[model samples]
Target: MSEPAMSEVVANLNLVRERIAEAAVRSGRAPDAVRLVLVTKTVEPSRILEAVRAGQADLGENKVQEGGRKADALAGEPVRWSMIGHLQSNKVKDVLRFADEVQSLDRRSLATALDKRLQSVGRGLDVLVQVNTSGEASKFGLTPEDVPAFLKDLAAFETLRPKGFMTLATFTPDETEVRRCFRLLRDIRDRARQDAPQGDTLTDLSMGMSGDYQWAIEEGATVVRVGQAVFGPRPLPDSHYWPGAAGTA
Candidate 1:
């Protein structure tokens, strides 16, 4: 498939932003309160540039290596980079090099690694603790009971700012379950704000993805990660980028 024209991408982004605004308003929250994070995993840099030009000030990449490459390519662009997927402890330093915020600080080791890396850089990082609210065996995150203590330990790291929480609801086409998990994250965010260490903000819930983002917004997702909904279903990895996976274009 040919890359979308810059104008077309901008139109699509505006439509998605409007949808987020509508969802936020329906939930009795201000539209500005909800931030749309364009999930750039597997997406070409051209689409990423389109999103940046369209006023998507925040972009999320799922892998550290991929994000690092993209960040280098898009250096000097007006965008905030977020690590929105599972981050390995050993990769923390590389990930923090371009990550303005990390939305997947789940394990204690990862947080500690990030803390050390950020301290070395002499910069503070905004982080959202990933919670496995869906109870999926494949997911990595702090359980509900582990959150408070995790927050306490994280607060000891001067360079790590515990801004909020993030979760990936089970990938079923079930809005009810999605909403339940989103609501749970919101409740946890509230509790974190109330119980967090002396100076933490505990705001910014980075929940939901393309499929269930409406439910996430209704349940108070300050940031939503969207990919196909904006760029269309991704081109297959091993295929040439054109119609019918060939040179028909």
Candidate 2:
């Protein structure tokens, strides 16, 4: 497929931002409270730089290695980077170099690995727990039943801060069902905050994507991960990052 004209892409971004603001208002939350994390998966760095120049503060990259490469390329750029897909334990160290926040801390093992890496670097990692609200067989996340133990175990890692929660909306595309899942993540966030240790911080609810972010915002998503809406559909990468020869979305 041919690349979209930059002007068209920029116009689409404005429309998405307007929709996000509208959702925030409808949810009785301040529009300023929500942050947009443009997903730059298969998008080239130049297009990402354009979004940054246009006032986008955060960028999400699915692969740690690719994200690191982009971070190195834009070393002086002022965009905050976020890791918003399944994180491999092996890539923990690589991710540490560029990710200001990781929003897919779904398993206890990954959290432990992250803590060890952060401790080695003498810096804490900001993170959000991913919940399997949709119960999808292909998804990776902690089930609701396991949240308590996960949170309790997470407290031991002072090098990682629990910022919020994240999840992929189901593929069925039911708006109400998607909102329900987002709401569940919000509730989990609240529960975690209430049960957290005295010094623990839980402030964000990241449970949206390009398709249903407005529903997420209406249901209380402080952060939204959008790909196609902002950069247009990503082109397939030259190589894949995982076993299926496919990269995370």
Error of 1 at 128 (Å): 0.6
lDDT of each: 0.79, 0.80
Tens-digit per-residue lDDT, 1-249, candidate 2: 999666765777788899999999999988777988988877778887778777887899878988999998888999899998788999998999999999989888898899888888899878888888887666778898888788888888899888777887665566777777888888877787778662246778887777788888888889988877877655554134322222223
Q: What are the TM-scores, per candidate, against the unseen true structure?
A: 0.89, 0.90
**Which residue runs of candidate 2 sit more than 4 Å off their true CA positions?**
1-6, 198-200, 237-249
Q: How close is candidate 1 to the true structure, as a TM-score?
A: 0.89
What does candidate 2 score on TM? 0.90
Model 2 lDDT-worst window of ten:
238-247
Candidate 1 per-residue lDDT, tens place, 200-247, comes to 488888887777787888888888888767877666541222111111
lDDT of 1 at 22: 91
Query: Which residue pairs in candidate 2 have backbone atoms (N, alpha carbon, C) closer than 3 angstroms, thus clashing?
Result: none
Model 1: lDDT of residue 241: 26
Question: Residue 72 CA error for candidate 1 (Å)?
Answer: 1.2
